[model samples]
Target: MDSRTMIASLPCLALVIVTLGYLGLCVVSPFGRCRACHATGRTRSRLGRIRRDCRHCAGTGLRLRVGRHVINHLHDEYEAAKR
Candidate 1:
């Protein structure tokens, strides 16, 4: 392909590659460490003396990946529609 054509398609190719990689990640490992508590399931107080459950992950130390959540929602919708 000509350099011009190649350059034009670069963004699209990058997007597809990223999308596929995320899908693979979702399938291989659906849950990722929570961001709020750094996967420790708890947060420390300002004084570092008290700990509280991570509100974002509900103390599980893991949260559903976005891609996996979207996949799940789509599957649920498909099933409901199939009924």
Candidate 2:
């Protein structure tokens, strides 16, 4: 209720908001893609049809890159906390 109490609570409130926002970004970011054969628009042939191998990662792999903004934000927080 008083000015002193309100000021003391500001940091905790800000931390909560920041943590929630970071989690939201992580959940919404596309970190991975499906790996499967693309021939005939299916992974398998149900009736003895031809199936083409996946072209994105050559059917043996997939790559994921971290969301840069998220990583940078975390790094910044770490540096701030250390100081």
The estimated TM-scores of all candidates read 0.85, 0.37
lDDT per residue, candidate 1, 1-83, as tens digits? Answer: 99999999999999999999999999999999999999999998789999999989999999999999999999999999999
Model 2: per-residue Cα lDDT over 1-83, one tens digit each: 99999999999999999977766665666344544532222344466575654555455444232454567688899999999
Best by TM-score: 1
lDDT for 27 (candidate 2):
62
Residue runs of model 2 more than 4 Å from their true location after superposition: 30-83
Compared with the true structure, model 1 gives a TM-score of: 0.85
lDDT of 1 at 22: 95
lDDT for predicted candidate 1 compared with the true structure: 0.96
